[model samples]
Target: MSDRAVPATPPPLFDTAVVAGVGLIGGSVALGLRQRFLARRVVGLDASMDVLREAEALGVVDEVRISPGEWLREADLVVLAAPMRALEPLARELAPFLNPAALVTDVGSVKSGIAAEMERLGVRHFVPGHPMAGSERGGVVHARAALLENAVWVLTPTDHTPLTALSRARTLVEHLGAAPVVMPPAAHDDLVATISHLPYLASLALTHMVARDERLSLLAAGGFRDLTRVASGDPRMSRDMIVENKEALRCALERFRRQLERLEADLDEPEELLAAAYEGKRTRDSLPVVKRSLLPQKHDLVVAVPDRPNQIGAVTQALGAEGVNIKDIEVLAIREEGGALRLGLESPEEVQRAAGILTGAGFEVRGRS
Candidate 1:
């Protein structure tokens, strides 16, 4: 969150930060808040007692409470990291309790519905966010501070959203090592419906179709595994995401259906379908390697290093000297000799400079994306 080095001590931005859920996204945000010193006091609210117990034990939150009252009122920043279904009602409860100057944000996938609810509740300082980061696995145990590293965290702010709320949410996104992209609520829903929501449904259909075939286990390979990977994620979360943004998803599904129809019509002319496939490939490949961003998008590079005590710091210091800020550093596959470590930086140029710095310092720099 500072200029370069992971601060030994960081100035807190919020007097109190409250996370309304203790699952993957919520827990990860809580972990980031602590790791980055983004908040002076961190608290969590979850209906699940088991989740609260796990989150507290994991030290993601300083305190955990089942219901909101004083805790909600004390928070300067409140993140509704609960399911999409939970946000509407939760906003209703917090409508009366929130600090007048507090900023409210959410990790819900869809924003239009949330925007509508906030409007209905007269919630002034609300920002809707969706961090395009997470794994197939869910829950607090799997939450990691680096889960958001180099990932996209979108802020969907309508004209009604206060500038202060938007700015605060963006700062939190960057502090967590994620790039923040700003857009309208409807535009975000329409965009993700094609890229995110559609993939989930497609993966679900493919996964189900394969499951019904007894021989699928034998035939399945990397391609099948890759295709159905989205389907393996938490079912309840996927269902909530799908149901919440049904309108945009409906349009996306219809478009996909039309594409299928075109391919079906081309069955008699195999070459036509092949041409269509090639065109699709070209369009997909043309998409920017870096997703669109409001800030300079963070880039990642892997460094192969000797398992020396200060090897990682050596790399960080090298970059720090160049004014290249390392957002995150992850050590991977440590062995007796050396290991691969990933460095996340604020831009593509920083990634290159950091990689060069590490390489010159006698560490092997590999993967960059």
Candidate 2:
């Protein structure tokens, strides 16, 4: 018996899907495609035979190859999950073997350059994409199909891109449990620079500044640790991302600098600093919650959980036993021996039921305000 959970009705299946560069992002995409039954076969391509072997052993791909070849002829879908700079070169090599109608996409963070490169190479049916999801850890061993769940997968399709191609990419995103968002390539690049790239840089800067003083770094607690956590991610990958999108990132940096300058100039005025902090808190809180496709907006319930070996597992198991489906979850805060978990449920009734269930289980539960 296969361990794979094949859906009763799979989405439009690709005859064969090719994923180049089987690292964290590539491995995750391959797993997602196979687990969702969106591809009849998932083939991994990487320059490293060692990486390919790991991917195959991990069941991230049905087959693995060190390079692109005639196998591309059978591929109806191709995902370039390599670094931003390598995407064009890899695409060039695979273009000839790919079927004329094959739909191609990428997980490259920066889309504008690749979009232009694909067009320059005359590669039709190419849709530049980026999934706003990943982990600090890298490698195939760390890849999980759940990594992309409820993620915002951005598809930056040019006007010249065929509707059929864009539709197919969206279908793949949906089947992978991601929400597809359409935007221009340049616009996508600019937006990610501010939200994604800028944050990484900020984390990197903060971590380096504090680490310069060992005693000071040793004293770093909750907020400081959380703020600098991203600095622990793959430095090579982070370097490539910020460099590839430097122009937009520079603009974002300048905007941030101005904000800092204003705050610094008003350091003597405590009220001004407090007001600015309040403004930031309000803006951050007002950011719209992510709603997965094909599902109603989720209602949130906050549960205060005591720190214990299996507190989270116990809560999940208890909810599972009651057939309560948690659409999403987040660890809101942690202090000393306890923390709060926010659970997202389908309906208000489910929220109420979940609150009562947890409360009955001796947990302090509260509905979102």
lDDT, each prediction: 0.80, 0.82
- For each candidate in turn, the TM-score is 0.75, 0.75
Across residues 1-369, which tens digit of lDDT does each residue of candidate 2 receive? 875322122232587999999988899899877655557789999999999988988889989999888878888999999876788799889887888889999999999888998898888899999998888888988887667878899999998999999998997887677889999998999999999899999998888888788887678888898888878888888898899999999999999899889999879899999999999999999997765333233487656666565677767877899999988877643444455566779889999898788877777665532
lDDT at residue 33 of model 1 (Cα atoms): 73
* Model 1 Cα lDDT, one tens digit per residue, 1-369: 644332122246677999998899999899777655567778999999999999988788889999888658889999999877788898888788888789899998998999888877887889989998878888889886668766888999989998988998887787667889999999999999999999999999887887899688788888989888998888888899999889999999999999889889999888998898899899989975643223322477766555456666777878889888878766543444445566777778877777777766666564321
Pairs with steric clashes in candidate 2? none
Error of 2 at 319 (Å): 20
Off by over 4 Å in 2: 1-12, 288-369
Report the number of the highest-lDDT candidate.
2
